[model samples]
Target: MTTRMNEYKQQIITDFNSRINYDNEFRYRFAKPLIELAQLKPGQRVLDVATGTGIVAIAAAKIVGDAGYVLGVDISTGMLAQAQRKVELEKLQNIELLEADADDLNFDDNSFDVIFCSAAIAYLTDVFTSLCQWYRFLNTGGIVAFSCFAETAHTASILFREKAQIYGITVPNPNATLGNPEKCQYLLQQVGFQNIKVVTQQFGFYLNDAESAWNANANSAYGYQVFQLPPDKLAQLKTEYIAEIHASSTEQGFWHDVNSLFVFARKS
Candidate 1:
């Protein structure tokens, strides 16, 4: 990997570690469908990539029971720390947590019956290499499943971008690639995954008000980029950005539309 790839990995790790205290019930809620889609069964070996807080990993461990095993790998120690706590709290002996990069997943050929990733594929620099690694590690009939933001996911950020452009502040959308169903399919196909299927889900995050919207934004990858903008532009951005967020709110609070895509495939 290049220096840039290393930087991306570090940035992602920092961001997620910083987010350990935020409202993350969604991560736990998301585990059920992700585990189900992977078709986890009793006594099957499972691997969970980016197992933040052990949501998916712990859930898989319960399903796999004592006769099976699950390995959860992540690049962030902060996340794994929380995951370890959860594992101990549950008294689960079937799962192991390790700090490792998804960029180079070193595992034996056909080692796992199921591999799962959730809501973290976009942070990866190259989807192809990760997908190929997944293919190699999965058993011949094993399944690989993951969830990602669709191209149209982050409406608040889109609104912020339009406002920022008015002030001559242009930054990259962190989710610019492999977000839509088409791109998701293309990447998996190129990596020789079979039975490729993508499920699109439309939802929204309920921010209590405009201030809450800004708070959420400030905690995101876009917020980090926005903070680095020139002072004058950043000031202008804050004004219009807040106004846009306020305008989108209602009695039910501000609703940020979340469009997500769930990608699943099998190693043939």
Candidate 2:
């Protein structure tokens, strides 16, 4: 990996380790639909990359049954700890959680029957490099499925970037690349994947209030933009962001829609 890429990986590992470990009610929402796109069968070996808390991995293990095995890998020790605990608690003998980097995975070529990633692909600094590696690791006729935030997914980041522009600040959002169907398909095709398909899901949840909204934004990759401001400017930025969410709020609560792009590709 290039120095730049390695640096970004470390940044991602640090930022995500805290919030995603025990995401009981929130991100776990994507597990079923993301795995359904895989079309997995019994006794098939599966790999779940960046498997935060093993949501996708554990779900796959159930479908694969005892004859099959599922490996859930992540760079965060904290995340793997949570995943291991969940797997053990559920008595899922077929699922294994490992602390490993997704970009430079160390697995034999053509080993896995299915590879899945959920809401974690954007953190990969080099998309093509990693997808090519996944293609190599997947067995012939194997399937690869993953979910990424659709272009319109992160409304806070949209507001962050929008508001920042007025203050002469430019927020960088790498997640935007996989937001739409066209971009997702083009990347998969470049890596020699066929039968490429995308399913769009709109998962809108209600935040209790503006504080809840701000905390959600601070926990994800959007936090980078939140922290970019100087200490003096940060207070002002927070005030603006809180109001941004409140402005979009209704009498019940603040509403945020999470659009997920579930992409599936085949190796054959």
lDDT of 1 by residue, 118-219 (tens): 888776667788889889999998999998886667788777766766665564575667778888888888888889988877757766666556556655
Candidate 2 C-alpha lDDT tens digits along 36-85: 77888899999999998788898899999999999999988878888888
Winning model by TM-score: 2
The residue pairs found clashing in candidate 2 are 150-179, 151-179
Query: What does candidate 1 score in Cα RMSD to the true structure?
Result: 2.2
Model 1 scores a C-alpha lDDT of 0.79
lDDT of 2 at 3: 70
Model 2 error, position 214 (Å) = 2.3
